[model samples]
Target: MESSVFFENSEKKKKAIGIIHRVYLSQLKNSRKYLASTKTKSEIRGGGRKPWKQKGTGRARAGSIRSPLFVGGGVIFGPKPRLVYKKINKKERKLATISALFLKEKQLVLVNENEFLNFDQIETKLICQLLSKFELEEQKKILFILPKPNKKFWLSSRNLKNVEVTTVTCLNLKQLLKASHIILSKESFDLIKLTYGQQ
Candidate 1:
């Protein structure tokens, strides 16, 4: 496929920008864990009995020790675990992924499959050498897209905090947008072209 196909014109670029933003936000929302939960008065322990009589001597009227007014009491209107997923349509996601790729085209690097297959053992040094060869050693976040899963390659690159390896099938907008540089195998590049080029 021609590289020109990935280059969007002015009007299309505007639309792509919106799509990319929406998709990126949606990805973040869906992956977020709503674990910030607080206990309510009823759910608090040791709250079964009233702390004091409703008509107390000099203290304020107290019901349960779990009242929100207490220091160790349950929270009021506090956060609870709930879903915050934003559903993104398949076509919209595809367009956003394509748009991200287009925007980051300068950071994309293509390599032959043989280059990775040449690694005989699981060694971080090999991956480091490869990055040095591509002049991506200084990049903060590098993503490797492979046509298929390779245990050896994945293992070799796993130790690098800045490098991540993933198969094309698992590619998503979050990964693409987070990467400072994306290394694609020739076959993986072709696969992406075939899958997203038509759109």
Candidate 2:
């Protein structure tokens, strides 16, 4: 009994194309931060003058140009030399992925097991056809979970503003839930399954 293969909902031995897992969104933690790893001295040099006499001006004495109070001064409590990436335990990440995949299993996430490494306009056509069959064309947000960087694939959906694309490795919880639909390529789906040996 190989776990990689699955039974279709309607046809026995027909083989379900996608994997399924029972998990929750909470299991997944945001592991990336937009403001991270700032260089202590990233070459933004402008902190030079003492600014007015120390004993003459009524204004409070000023210090380094890098002071956060001054305009163009170094940022205070701002993004700095810190790692923003949060780690979700391997099990939790897998669990979240599984939860996502389970949604796919129910057809909320469209699995194009037939789609692959190459790009094809006809592929888009076929995908549209599937959407049409499922009445998914009107979906406001459709996200594509790509396996990796593929120029052809990137171009396929660029024209559609509502269609968002991302790689499995770059999966974000907000983006995942924001979309009403998810398109999964066969290779990327397998990679996720392999990640947990859940298959």
Candidate 3:
């Protein structure tokens, strides 16, 4: 089958294919970098004064309550939150997104345009039935992309553990690449073409 609309014209997709690993690893590293760490010594409370006399006790030299050797002591060499944002060139970011999009093209499922011109009304039963019809019921992870925010559809799919709903404008590489199946509303498909293909 032919490649998706975004990949139809330029060598952008080819460029993306060449640097997939660099982009993906950059993403993976950045994802873990920003998360706050729990065991920092400063965050731990109460390491005030020396516990006992230093020499008379004949035990390990007593130190402040925060000594690492003590029971309630502060952590030693624990992790702390640090800057983790990786900067990729704008063109590279776009290329990586397009690359991921093209890679996932075969798994893309575009809603039938004839069934519903505007799928504004979110009905759980109807959505579930559609899932069955599309043979997506068994998929472990599915992403629902809409042209814009639809409170109704988002609420409807909120209960499905394996499904997520988002608009084309807010598409993120992490979320896009993580899903096993991508169900794009007709409007979303059009928006994606306009947004990425134009570049």
Candidate 4:
């Protein structure tokens, strides 16, 4: 395969990496989700009856067992289960992704598909040894973008620290920015262009 196959991009050179930070946080915020929930006042038990008469008890007017002041009472205005995802435009997503591609310097490495085929079998140790050949074993953060999701490849790299494997379709701005070093499978390189370069 040609070395230029991985780096060919009409806009890569003109694109500024710094531009991505503008929308990075927004994209990240929208992507994350949490299963948060809280109980309402009425949901609390034992609030059925009044604790005392309304008038002259002189005890500051006690209510039911489920009052906010009570030990086991429901929380007041606590977090509720609601979606917090922010909407991002397709153009913005494309811009952010392209910016990440442009940001890569010497840290980006491309692996030809033939190299993977040379492996007798896929294994964690085998993948590590392969990376050592590139002197990449010590890299603190590495991301591998496969052209397509390969279960064997994912399993092979899953156990390695500072290593993550994802397919082209799953690529996002967050993963692209998180890694210090990026490895693009030959197919992934082409797919990125096809998916994001036309516009």
Show how many residue pairs clash in every candidate, following the order shown.
0, 1, 1, 0
TM-score of each: 0.86, 0.48, 0.69, 0.79
How accurate locally, in lDDT, is each candidate?
0.84, 0.57, 0.72, 0.73
Any idea what lDDT model 2 has? 0.57
Writing each residue's lDDT as its tens digit, candidate 3 over 59-170 gives 8886676667767666777666688777777677766766777788878888865433344676777668768988886457888887767787787778788888888878
Residues 1-199, candidate 4: write the lDDT tens digits. 3324433664643444444765687776776776677776689867889978989887878677687788888888887766787666777678678657755646788888765555555689877876897788545788888776677777888788889888777887888888888888667788987877633
RMSD of 4: 4.3
Off by over 4 Å in 1: 1-3, 51-62
Give the lowest summed-lDDT range of ten residues in model 1: 1-10
Comparing candidate 2 with candidate 3, which one achieves the higher TM-score? 3
For model 1, how does the per-residue alpha-carbon lDDT over 1-199 read when each residue is reduced to its tens digit?
A: 3436655567777888899999888888899999899999889888778887778378898888889999889999999999887889988988888778878888899898888778678999999999999888645899999888889999998899989998877888888988999998778987886777546
Task: Please give the range of 10 consecutive residues that has the lowest summed lDDT in model 4.
Answer: 1-10
Poorest stretch of ten by lDDT in candidate 3: 112-121
Residue pairs with backbone atoms closer than 3 Å in model 1 (clashes)? none
Task: Give residue 108's lDDT in candidate 3 (0 to 100).
Answer: 88
Error of 1 at 163 (Å): 1.2
Question: Alpha-carbon error at 162 in model 4, in Å?
Answer: 1.0
**Could you say which candidate leads in lDDT?**
1
What stretches of model 3 exceed 4 Å from their correct place? 4-15, 33-76, 113-122
